[model samples]
Target chain A: MAADKVDPIHQFHITKILPINVGHYDVSFTNSSLFMAMTVIAATAFLILATSGRSMVPNRWQLVAEMSYSFVANTLRDAAGKAGMKFFPMVFSLFMFVLVANLLGMIPYFFTITSHIIVTFCLAMLVISTVVIYGIWKHGFHFFGLFVPSGVPAALVPLVTMIEVISFLSRPISLSVRLFANMLAGHITLKVFAGFVVTLSAAGVAGMAGAVLPLAMAVALTALEFLVAFLQAYVFTVLTCMYLNDAIHPGH
Target chain B: MASNVNTTAEVHHGGAEHGGAFPPFDSSTFASQILWLAITFGLFYVLMSKVVLPRIGGILEARHDKIAKDLEEANRLKADSEAAGAAYEKSLAEARKKAQAIASETRSVLNAALDAKRHEAESSLSTKIAAAETAIAGIKAKALAEVDGIAIETAETLVSTLAGESVGRDEVAAAVAAVTAK
Candidate 1:
């Protein structure tokens, strides 16, 4: 057994690359920042390259681009109707960033940006804030009616309202934790299985034979993680649309 | 197996010691991560809203309009050709009817002309026949009178020759008449 070994959790560490200080505030560039930029660049390049031709009779790449565009567009339309399309940019960017981050994390050496609670929480905060601010702006005092259930018995109104408020407040927490936990757990499991492969293969030939099982499991988990990557992005975008629907129409 | 267990334990210990209790719980990097997230998200939003989405939307809208316009034009052309075809068919039917009417009228007119000509020829032939019959009757009466004179003369000559003297024409005629009556 070696005293120093590679740690699976260490992949989640954020190290400062360039240090900047302004009045005791640390705003240095880091690996997370780099990946975020890369996500943006990758998304931008993909969209630009795919649509550069803008052919009416779309080629394969254009079809893919159009499919993704219409996918989010249809989801928003279905979840929140046409009014939800106003936030298409925000929702699309969030989905792409998270999706690309999750996929990139599957690479052997790349960091998983969405695995960090800060990133997921920030995204969730943005969604909740938009809902709150827009709801108040659009509905004014009537927005509070969202807490009241119309079919409730008069005696149970307070209890229903309390439950509604609690659920409402928990939206950001659940949204952030859902994505963060899934990514974090998936990445950890993959690393552990991969570690098992490395450890077993380092043993005798018999151990190497056993290592095939963990390697196969890691491979299967990877495939599952790819599906999860896409699913989580879709879930996040769908929930964002639903929340926006609440803002647009602030009643139960 | 013992070595494998030892390495597994060391891996766990190393993960906890070196990578902290949880790498995400490390607070030193939150500010930069959030800041960069905000910046990158804002950039992406701007690019999507201002540049990419509108372009795609415009292309889609353009294609929709083109398809609709092409369909409308095709419908118009089809309708126009159908109308022309109907008009052509109607005119063809009318032409056939007119030709048939002309042919029947011409046949009737030609038949009437032939009937008129035949009637005129028949009337002329009947008049000619009546004239020819009247002439034949006159010729027969004249021939009878001449024969009477010749017979009287011949009888007078014969009587004169037999009696050795000339007889009178009035008497001979009276004698012939009496013998013919008997």
Candidate 2:
């Protein structure tokens, strides 16, 4: 097999289209940046244009836009309550970015932005920082109360507090890793199964006949990857809402 | 087609020049990814907050207000129709009552005129009958007196003719009267 055909990691390569160094940082415009820009632009255009008519009885695209709005709105509201509605813009942006980025990645030869740990980590940190800043800002020192469970026996307070602190601190890592790993692993698995088909079919008639199994498996995995794409985006956003809930309520 | 991108994540692209550093784990890409994430996400947040949300929310609120106004208008029209229907029913009942009163009054007036005519006709007929009865009584008395005189004359003439002798009118009258009396 050719070297390019052997490397699934090649899909994730951030080829620099333009180099733009800011101070000491290598903040070049890469393929990753390209897809991120596309995701936002596409999302923005769809939302803005879909509602342009402001039709009482919405058309098909308008309905989709409205449903997306209400869907994320309800997700945030359910997790964080009415007060959480204040973070709607931030939460909604994250959801749209992740969802669009993941689905865009499903296209052949397209870059999956969320597949990178740095990207997902930053998105997760956006959520975590918002939670910490808003929680502490709103509740002052009382936000620390989120670490202490009210119903726990006094004997286990120290132990439980330690566990809560670890869990609380691990939120960004877990959240980021969950989405990044799912996208990276799913795409890799699909590529492997699909590669088996190509490698086997290249051999001979007997090997060509054996190629159908992996080919069929690849087809099913593609379908499953599409689901994973959407699911990971949702998981990331929903976890974001839950973390934001800690900011609004702050009490266990 | 993405399935054809090869398997084995173990095979890192040697061309990337970052050596064995995995693309995701590569810290060199982090700066750009973070920078782009901020820019794109910031733009999205601004667009959503400034334009899209307000427009959609306005459309919804306007629809809600319109629906409420329409319902209030419908209720007012219903109440007006009911009032009109009640007035129609009341006037119809009054007209029916007036018609009944007029009919009764006309019948009473007709009956009174008819009774007066009947009473005058009956009284005039009774007076004429009483006058006819008195005249008939007078005629009957005169006839009876004439019949008595004729009977005395005939008796005198028959006696004279049989005896062939003259007699006094006074004596003949006395004899005839005595026979008639007997």
Q: Would candidate 1 be rated incorrect, acceptable, medium or high by CAPRI criteria?
A: acceptable
Q: What are the candidates' individual DockQ scores?
A: 0.32, 0.33
| TM-score between candidate 2 and the true structure | 0.74
**What ranges in model 1 sit over 4 Å off?**
A1-10, A20-26, A192-221, B1-19, B118-182
Q: Please report, in order, the local distance difference test score of every candidate based on alpha carbons.
A: 0.86, 0.85
Candidate 2: regions farther than 4 A off: A1-7, A21-24, A196-228, B1-12, B71-182
Global local distance difference test of model 2:
0.85
Chain B: TM-scores of all predictions: 0.69, 0.64
Residue A105 displacement (Å), model 2: 1.6
Could you give candidate 1's per-residue lDDT for residues B31-138 as a string of tens digits?
888899999989988998899889888888888899999999999999999999999999999999999999999999999999999999998998998898888889
> How well docked is model 1, in DockQ terms?
0.32
Task: Name the lDDT value of residue A41 in candidate 2.
Answer: 87
Residue B182 displacement in candidate 1 (angstroms) = 13
Q: What share of the true interface contacts does candidate 1 keep?
A: 0.65
